[model samples]
Target: MRLFDYELSGNCYKVRFLLHALALPYERRAMNFHPGREHKAAWFIEHHHPRGQLPVLEDDGVSIPDAQAILVHLASRYDPAGQWYPDDPAIRARIAPWLAVADDLTGSAGAARLHDAFGYPLDIAACRRAARAVLRRLDDHLAEGASGGARWLAGTPVPTIADIACFPYVALAPEGGIALDAFPALRQWVGRFRRQPGFIGMAGIMAPQIGP
Candidate 1:
């Protein structure tokens, strides 16, 4: 397997995190996503992702694009125990909406991050507002679930793709100038996620230090 990766991209980080969690070995084809704009180059666009997106996965002669779609594919294919993405219908039903929420986060918080970090032209204020709204919804959902002893986005005993889908940008919201301080439940959820076994972090999101 080969991953078309961008070192600082949260979307790319999601795929890398799952690969590490599954202990799946794959070659990292680090792309020049920043000043170089290699993802927008003709070869990449013609072959990997027509949308010129990073985090495209190539395995067994098949190419897969879109971070959320990649997460589902990796979980379904590599996770033998069915943990990251369970086979249960009810659980999957619960998981689906959060996947969409992840996309919402990308548009809002993600755009804000690109603007602040990479100097992309965008309405920073509007982006932050959208991010806050999504964060509030997520915090409320997590808070409600915590009231019933559920910690994961899908209310599963273990972290599912739902958690993986939503975790990164939420954890990195501060980098986009959207603070998590007001959302205590969301903050707690992020902390819990960071501590999960096999967890890895990318730029702006640190992997927790183990042991004393």
Candidate 2:
């Protein structure tokens, strides 16, 4: 198995975190997106994904793109007992909405911070506002016990890909100036994630609150 990923990307970190948690071993191929390494390369497009996105997973001859899709695939293949993803239809339904929120909050807010604060610097105030809104939503959700008293997002006894998917960006949000102190529940959740075995920090990133 091989994982093609960008070291600094939260999306890529999602896959890496899950794989490490599962004790799955694979060759890591780091891609350089800054110099258009992923975009300008024909081999990458043809063999991996034409979308030129980082965090492309190759298991044997099969290739999977999109962080959520990769999570599903990893859980299904590595954990068929549905520990990471429940088999019950109702549980699955409940789990699905959190994934959407994770994608929106973590994906959107993370990108906003990366582009505005680190990469290009466009409208820092707007980006910070958007990131704060997402954090507040997560704070409220966790306070409501959306995880059913479990420490993770999917209500599982252990952390699932759902938790893994959102951990990196949320943890590193402060580097983009999105404060975590306002979200106590979210902060506790991140603490639980860090204590888990085989956890790996996202490369070139810092959790201003958690301190990596």
Candidate 3:
């Protein structure tokens, strides 16, 4: 297996995070996304991904682009019990919408991180505001669920792709100037995620497990 990766990209980090959880071995094909813009190269464009995205997965001669799609593919293929993309139709339904929301988090928090940390040009204020909005919604949703004994986003006893999909950007939102102070549930969520076995971290994130 091979992963076309950029170390600083949260999208790329999601793939790496899950791969480590799954204990999958793969080679890292580093991409110079910053000053180099190697992802935009013609060779990568024509062969790897048309959009020049990072964290493209190459396995069994198939190249999969986009982080969310990669997660589904990996879970479906390797997860023997099928818990990540679970068998229940309702859980699957809940998981899909969260993946979409994960994209919004990417548009906001992920973009903000690029702007602040990597000198990419973007509206930092707008990004932070949008991220706060998402965080507010998620915080409320999780809090409401907590009343009914929900432990994960999909209301499952175990964490699902829904949780993993939304985690990295929210965990790293501070790097984008989005603070976690107002979202206590989200802070707890991040801490719980970090406590999960096989959790991994990237730049701007370390193991964030909280005290019990």
Candidate that would win on lDDT: 1
| Model 1: residues with Cα > 4 Å off, grouped in runs | none
Look at candidate 2 and give me any clashing residue pairs: none
User: Mind giving the per-residue lDDT tens digits that candidate 2 earns over 117-158?
Assistant: 457556667767877887787778777774467566766677
Clashes of each: 0, 0, 0
TM-score of each: 0.98, 0.85, 0.95
**lDDT of model number 3:** 0.90
Candidate 1 lDDT tens digits, 1-212: 99999989989999999999999899999999989999999999999999999889999989999999999999998898999999999999999999999999999999999999999999999999999999999999999999999999999999999998999999889999998989999999999999987678887898888887
Kindly indicate the candidate among 1 and 3 with the higher lDDT.
1
Worst window of 10 by summed lDDT in candidate 1: 196-205
Worst 10 residues of 3 by lDDT: 202-211
Descending-TM-score candidate ranking: 1, 3, 2
What TM-score does structure 3 among the candidates reach? 0.95
Clashing pairs in 3: none
lDDT of each: 0.94, 0.76, 0.90
